[model samples]
Target chain A: MKKINLVLFFLAALVAFVVNAQPPRPAPTPNDTLNSTKVLKDGRVMFSIYAPKASQVTLSGDFLKEYKPIQLVKNDIGVWSYTSDAVTPDVYSYDFVVDGVKTLDPKNVLLKEGENGYSNYFEVSGPESAYASIQNVPHGNLQKVWFFSKVTGKMTRFHVYTPPGYEKMKGKLPVLYLQHGGGDNDASWSTVGRANFIMDNLYAARKAVPMIVVMPMGHPGAGFFMNPGIDEDPYYKQMFDEIMPLVAEKFRALTDRYHTAYAGLSMGGLQAMNMALFSPQRFGYVLPLSTGYFPPQIKLLEEKYADALRNPEINKLKLFWICMGGQKDIAYQNGLNCNALFDKFGIKYEKANYDAGHTFITWRHNLEEFAPKLFK
Target chain B: MKKINLVLFFLAALVAFVVNAQPPRPAPTPNDTLNSTKVLKDGRVMFSIYAPKASQVTLSGDFLKEYKPIQLVKNDIGVWSYTSDAVTPDVYSYDFVVDGVKTLDPKNVLLKEGENGYSNYFEVSGPESAYASIQNVPHGNLQKVWFFSKVTGKMTRFHVYTPPGYEKMKGKLPVLYLQHGGGDNDASWSTVGRANFIMDNLYAARKAVPMIVVMPMGHPGAGFFMNPGIDEDPYYKQMFDEIMPLVAEKFRALTDRYHTAYAGLSMGGLQAMNMALFSPQRFGYVLPLSTGYFPPQIKLLEEKYADALRNPEINKLKLFWICMGGQKDIAYQNGLNCNALFDKFGIKYEKANYDAGHTFITWRHNLEEFAPKLFK
Candidate 1:
């Protein structure tokens, strides 16, 4: 009878373990019950955070003008809150500056990693942001691929997005070599730029041709840039020597100039411009966004590619597009100057501009607008 | 000449933009120059945080027993710092509790997403952690796959790892349906569990047969559990109905029972056990780490499959492995009591236990050991 009682108790303990086992979830504090962010029905966003000991709380995000951080008002219960004016429909990244230290919204799990730090991001979803939002359409597979870089002597990672029905597609796909900015990695375009979702929505809408988007690491090292010796840049060396060949072979990408395209933003834009000038016959489309080379690099390009820049093949590209974020963009003047040089060199390019500054907002818009025009 | 000088000044500004362009690289404060986490030469880790305003700072992580957070001492400049004792070479996740609020280390970019929040992770590299670390071996691709689940009626995401050279593999590959615990998503195994790297190293060393690893979302909703009426559970239904068929069709996976395996941890472990019991002929290998069924569920299984449990076919399973953490593990007693019932039903299984409690540390070790014995 004692043994039977012990067995029953053991069984009861087993049931308790089955019901109550886990690594004890992060205990929520008493005052942490409030939602930190709320996108109101009227397109206004409300931000809140609870920090009783903090002297100041402010909201800094891409939606704000000139990188300004707005202040939050604290209530009696130590929860600070802020309500914004009607914001346009778009995805935005933000961080809460608490007592001079930038902190992520503890209530928000969505994050976008930058070169220096990570920021919490949210979407004010509406019709305008429909292309970038996750829809009920067939989604693409984003592959985290690693390739050994002989130049860098490390296993570098990159991202590849195969569009819907790509696995069963009959013919080889055209490839787009997308590059991130100076302060981002390969994952930036897919995560923050919403490249996958954009493609999915575009495919569902029958607005674009299905293609493989390859995002590779642009910066070889901290200070590596496509400057005077652009051909010798480790990033360029790796892309041309290892990455491009791997993409062609492994992904069965179309290798002809008509099917290959190169596009990038900021520093990556500069790289794309260099790749276009260095090998004028390699890419059919070259798009550079929110970036321009310095005068010295432009001078080097003028001297180095004196023949290549003027060649009629350069004009034969399907698209040579250059875009900037209006006059307020940090690179606006620089881009204008670079275009002036291009005009002198008999280069042909289409230029466009948007109102957003040098941020992912402009880049996301750029991708959505340009991806459809590729492999046509 | 004056115009030429003005043009030269413009060139200087362009070069400055080239050199100093980016969303201003998250302006580092004067006091934030210290490295936030440093894995030292002696295998000790030193953590620092530049929180000048916080009153109390503490470190909480899996390495600390029973989830106890250790206090950090503040320096004269208000920087919180602590040096951990010699830690074994493995990956760890941690967070800084600042004034009772959990905060990530701003300087560290490596992050692991938990159910509620994100934690910064660092690695102490050594030969012992060689299987988990990113070695200079030919790595496989981890694809972020999306499938439409009728049960959940959403575009659910899962992770699939194809071994190195899988693109050119001649035949269909075996698959291990891996799952994360209650407090994680599909990405947890690849990121924190280091499942991809473990398989990579194991394949490189010829310790394990090359196989595809499929990790799916375990929790259908917040309070979803694999309790009574487990077959009707949405997670199980979705996995069997939608995800499995999609994998078989798209991945060209081997569908025979001998090449199929199911393994999970914590809540996922319980789900795996339920899956093995409910569909006894589906998986040849069943490995449930740090988990067991409750007594009522066991009684139901015993009553429903009284003849099936003692059938010789159940004994013909290639591997029925159950593992747990040592005495301090929350599920240790529950596992023993459940095994007692298995003995009464004449079930057979291989059990293993490690010293670490119910944490990823133990599960990682469990994977490193059991994965080699799978699909042999």
Candidate 2:
């Protein structure tokens, strides 16, 4: 009877070993445990960094006035964290200055390349910033297309966004020629502006028509749009002649002007104005966000295209929408001055005003408000 | 006469000031001045970090045998730099431990996400590492595609690479189903492996056929490929049923076994073996790099598909290539054992060996050698 009890005990121990032999759970990674940047529900942002040995850490960004650097306090676990006041809905770029060395937030992956260096960015969004937020809706496809640019004498790339159901549903889709700001390329609109998500949510709510959006690089060479001798007109010509034709041929894009629109932000805004004023018959709708023509540029446009602006056949524009941020915006006075000039030329236009100033939020709002009003 | 002379002197001074008024040159950023990592022409790598404040710095990486850390010396410019002895052609991940705190290369952007943290990676290339090097050729387009996976029940994303001239080309292209190793997503193969550039150069030299490469996530949920509950068969099924069908429908792809190939590295290699054995009819060519079936796995495969392996009609494989590093590799013995099993079963296969041990260079060399033999 004792021998039988010993055998049963050994069997029970074996079962316990087998049960405990399951794979061990993986330890949480630093990215999983650390909250480097968190967007609170109240539109405030909390930034943290792991620097146990460092004596001091500070945060600096363009969103702050005069680019002031804010100090952070250390916690029990050796993490330095700082919470900012309730900031408005906008994408902000920042970096951690640890012991006087500018260090990127190791926890944050969303980075933007700037003139000086790369800056980590986070978005503070609420109902007011709904257009840029991800919603429960069918998303569109963002494609990278590479083509030879005759003007640039090199291979260039552009991003094309085909609306949801574009593959299964076969129909000619209208195209929107979207452009990015200075120092950015074709990827800006979809990546930074969240244009595809914005369009997806708009389409889900039936607020906007489903159309293909084409974002092309505004600057093909190493120069800004406002710089002299950049000669953006030739690049624009190349777009209409080569790039647009290729886009239409490869994708299911309509070739007619009535099914085409042009929109851009900042330097892209300037390019859009140039395209509209010069090649008025190429696009039916035009929207220039957060950019306006100065007096010299307006004079140049009037002198160059007096007959086209006066001719109803060539100036058959369906919508000329101009959008800008509030009075605090650097371009606000310029926008007003340009509007007065447009009135003097008897050019009909629509305008939009947002509370934000010269930020992606303002441009996103412009896209949200303008995209729905197009192709009507 | 004195007043006139004074006015002339003042005019000369004003001219000098105007000449100097041209905008001052901006200071160089860390990326411009420091060479955090540089691959010498002779295959040696030099790494530098600008940490003047730190008392000590060391370099640690998988390339180092015994996983030892090497100390770095500080230069006059307050930059800590280290040059390693002639390393072989491969990609390596490393970090600088500055004053006992781990830090990434601020200048280097090519980073690999590991289980614990992100590591900065550098590639060493020469004539031998031709496939991984960026040769002057027409590059392919790397696209990010988002699709819903019914198996995972989430919106999964994958990257697709189309060879140059895919848009303009007028024929159905072959496809290569590529997979990443454990702990890596679909972006790993393209971003880290430089697969697109490899294909571009290969196609330019007419060594390899132009094909569409689809890289999909190996693990669907929160587990590694080797874990028990992470049954990769369903994920492979999803790839064949949904992802491949989508690729075929959207892109110009040939939908036959003769036009399809399969290859993967590490855990992905294990997956490739499983898929090729189970779904032999789906792929004509199979190459498992730096991974192979162990004795137990081979036994299981033989047991499950004894009749299928013996049947010539069902086992009509064009190529069964297995590749791994030298004897130092952890998987080298398993690969040999698997080959012996194949020999016993009268299965024909090709094998290649490299000098390295279970590194990306070994897998890259495998791809370089194997891709040329596919779809010929």
Best by DockQ: 1
TM-score of 1: 0.92
lDDT at position B335, candidate 2:
78
Q: Encode model 2's per-residue lDDT on B1-376: one tens digit a residue.
A: 1111122223323334444654322245443466777877776788888776667888877566533579999887678888887776767767676655566566766665432345567776656566776655676777777777777677766778888877678889999988877545676677666777778878988999889998887766665443111144567767877789888877789979989998987678877776566667888998887776555566666777676556563358798888887875656766787778677778787888876766555666677778888888
Give each model's whole-structure lDDT.
0.79, 0.70
lDDT of 1 at A96: 83
lDDT of 2: 0.70
lDDT of candidate 2 over A153-172, digit per residue (tens): 77677888888778676778
Q: RMSD per prediction, one decimal?
A: 6.0, 9.7
Docking class of 2: incorrect
TM-score of each: 0.92, 0.80
Q: Any residue pairs clashing in model 2, and if so which?
A: none
Q: Give a tens-digit lDDT track for model 1, residues A1-376.
A: 1111122233344555557754233345545576777888898888988887788888877777755668999888778888887788989877887777667677778887656667788888889989799888888899988877888888788889999888777889999999987767788888888999999989999989999999998776656475734556788888888888888766768888989899998878888888777776889999999888766677777888688677788788889999998876777877998899889988889998877877788988998889889998
